[model samples]
Target: MKVLITGKGGQLATELIKVFPNKFDVVALSSHELDIVDAESVERSIAAVKPAIVINAAAYTAVDKAEDNQQRAFDVNYLGCENLAHACKAAGCSLIHVSTDFVFDGKKATPYFVDDVPNPINVYGASKLRGERGITNVLEDAVVIRTAWVYSGTGNNFVKTMLSLMQNKPELSVICDQIGTPTWANGLAQFILHIASKYGEGERQSLVPKPVTYHWTDAGVASWYDFAVAIRDLGIEKGILKQAIPINPIPASQYPLPAERPSFSVLDKTETEGSTGFKTTHWRHQLDKMLDEYTEDSKLSEGKT
Candidate 1:
């Protein structure tokens, strides 16, 4: 079985490779190897590898900055995906496309299901939704997985940012307005690779390598304030920090940003449940597992040996 992955440098791609490095003839390419912005490069790379399965992890993910860089964002996210989808279709290969939940407008109180219409409020979100459309339009055998609030053992993410600020500042202010499910990149990588492998074998008779999509997110919803505070509290309890000061909660209006984020972006996993017959790990469980690596003392003290 052969698998090709774009965005070799991205956080999620890094975790994906780590968890599933042995699963296939893994070809991990970064921007330097195959610039997604250049259709020629994308085509040439795809033609050269012709892997049985392609996992596209590349994207223009800068949220606030995308407001001023719409063209750049669209070029990389939408057009690049178009290139990839077209290439995969030509090769008769399956594609596993990753997407963001920022595509929603955050108007609903409950979780957004797979069938909900995407109404992006920002340039980044719009670009991602456009990319999703591109994949669906171009590829007959594509699996779209939309996820949110992702973090990993490596990378600059919410958890790392919270830990950094907690160490440097006496107190911090985080907006309480935005809420979403946090998905662990490692866990997601495992699930996707399992499907990718089956795709290679042409098994999973009931599942579609064709025009299918699912929402994959960790269990439980959390406001940005809630997530940040939880991290600080856990850090203190685990003795990763000498002390954790108060993390102040502020309204979204009080802390304005360049991008208009969805106040809510929770994704319902009913489709994922039906397909995978498994549920995602809870956010607390995922975070605790990652945090444990930083607290070997806590592990030993708790007699986890």
Candidate 2:
């Protein structure tokens, strides 16, 4: 099987590569190698590789920054996805598009389901919803997987931010009102592969089958404050840190930012778990695993054999 992935250097894309190392003939591209915003460049890359499957991992992920720079975010997140979808259609390849929970307005008391309608309040969510629409509209065999609060072994994410904040501040202030699940990049990446690979089997058949979208993340939900507390607790459990100042919970208003965030952004996993046949780890378990890896990495970097 030949699979091509975008955003070569991102945390989620990097995890997909790590988990599926040498399993398939893989062609990974950074934005520099193939800019998604440029139509001709995207077409050329897709034609050159001729992959059986294409995973759209490249995205405009700077949420707060996007409030100030809407055009660039739309250019990359919306227009870029349109390019990928069109390329997939022209190449006769099945496409898997990564999306975010931000697509919803966070009005529901329950978790967002695959069937739920999206009502985005922010530019970042609006752009991503456009990306989802682009992929689903262009490709009959495409899969759109929406995830939340993704962190990985590579790249900047919430876990690393908490660790850094604890070291510098006497007390860390986090938003306790906004609730969502924190997903390990590996969990979501693997889930995408299982869905993409299976769905591709009948993609080019004589009769087109129904296209599907799925939602996935770690099992449990927590607010940003809860996540930070768990991160610090895990670090202590793993013996990586002797001590750190406790993290404090504050309402969303206490820490104001450019972008507006959803108060509740959890996603339902009924369809995703059913299709993938892989159970997602609880957020707490994932947190421990990440902390352990961080501890090992720190030791290695310090030249500790």
Candidate 3:
């Protein structure tokens, strides 16, 4: 199988490349190389590569910046997917788009289901929602997997930010009110590969049904404060951090940002698990695994230097 992955240097895309099986021929491209926002470029790339499947990991993911740069967000998130959908349809290949859980407003206290209606509260979420609609409209068989609170050892995510802050600051404050799961990019990457493999084996009807949207995250939930505290303790245990500092829990109002996040955005993964037969690891376990990997990588880098 020949797979083309966008956002080659991103957290999830990076993990995808690392975990991808050797049986498949993968072509991962960064935005500078592929330029998904350019319709002609996307069409030309797909036509030339002639991939069996195109996994769209590219997205405008700056949550707060999306407020001021709504046009750019829509351009990349909405128009980019639209462009890819058209290109995939013309090229006779499938598309698997990675979406976000922010499509929900977070008004509900429970985990969000795939069938639940999306009512995004911020520009980023709204733009992503538009992208989802665009894919469904253009290609009915396209798979859209919505994930949340993603972090990896390779990128500028919450886990890396917390580790940096804990190393420098005496004490830190994180929002306790906002709640969601912290998904390790490795896990999401595996799930996407599983989907691609299934599709390659001509299991498209079973793997991707109508209303092809699904939710995936590591099991368990945590607020920003909880996530930060876990990072601190794990970082220390893994020798990634020198010591743990006092992490004070604060409400969202205490640290307002340009974007309004969902207070609770836990996604229900029942449908995803049932369909794919893939069990999810808990967020804390995944965090520990990631930290361990980070520590080992740091040790190797130091040895090389």
**Residue 133 deviation, candidate 3, in Å?**
0.7
Per-residue lDDT for 1-305 in model 3, tens only?
Answer: 99999998999999999999899999999999899999999998998899999999999999999999999999999999999999999998999999999999999999999989999999999999999999989997999999999999887999999988888999999999999999999999999988888987888987677648879999999999999999999888887889889999999999999999999999999888998998899999999999889888888999999
Badly placed stretches (over 4 Å) of model 2 are 199-208
Please provide TM-scores, in order, for all candidate models, with all chains considered together.
0.93, 0.95, 0.98
Ranking by TM-score: 3, 2, 1
By summed lDDT, which 10 consecutive residues of candidate 1 come out lowest? 197-206
What digit string (tens of lDDT, one per residue) describes model 2 on residues 1-305?
A: 78889999999889888776465788999999989999999999999999988888899999999999999999999899999989888888878889999999999879999889999989999999998998788888777889999997688999988887776778888899999999999888878776655644653443226557788899998999899989888877777656867777899999988889989999999776875677888999988887787788888989964
The total of clashing pairs for model 2 equals 0
Runs of candidate 3 exceeding 4 Å displacement: none
For candidate 1, report its TM-score: 0.93
What's the CA error at residue 28 for candidate 2, in Å? 0.6
Model 1 residue 1 CA deviation in Å: 0.9
lDDT of 2 at 39: 94
- Residue 101 in model 1: lDDT: 93
The local distance difference test score of each candidate is 0.86, 0.86, 0.93
Give the least accurate 10-residue stretch of model 3, judged by summed lDDT.
205-214
Against the true structure, candidate 2 has what lDDT?
0.86
Task: List model 1 lDDT by residue over 124-146, tens digit each.
Answer: 99999999999999987688999
User: Top model by lDDT, which number?
Assistant: 3
Better of 1 and 2 by TM-score: 2
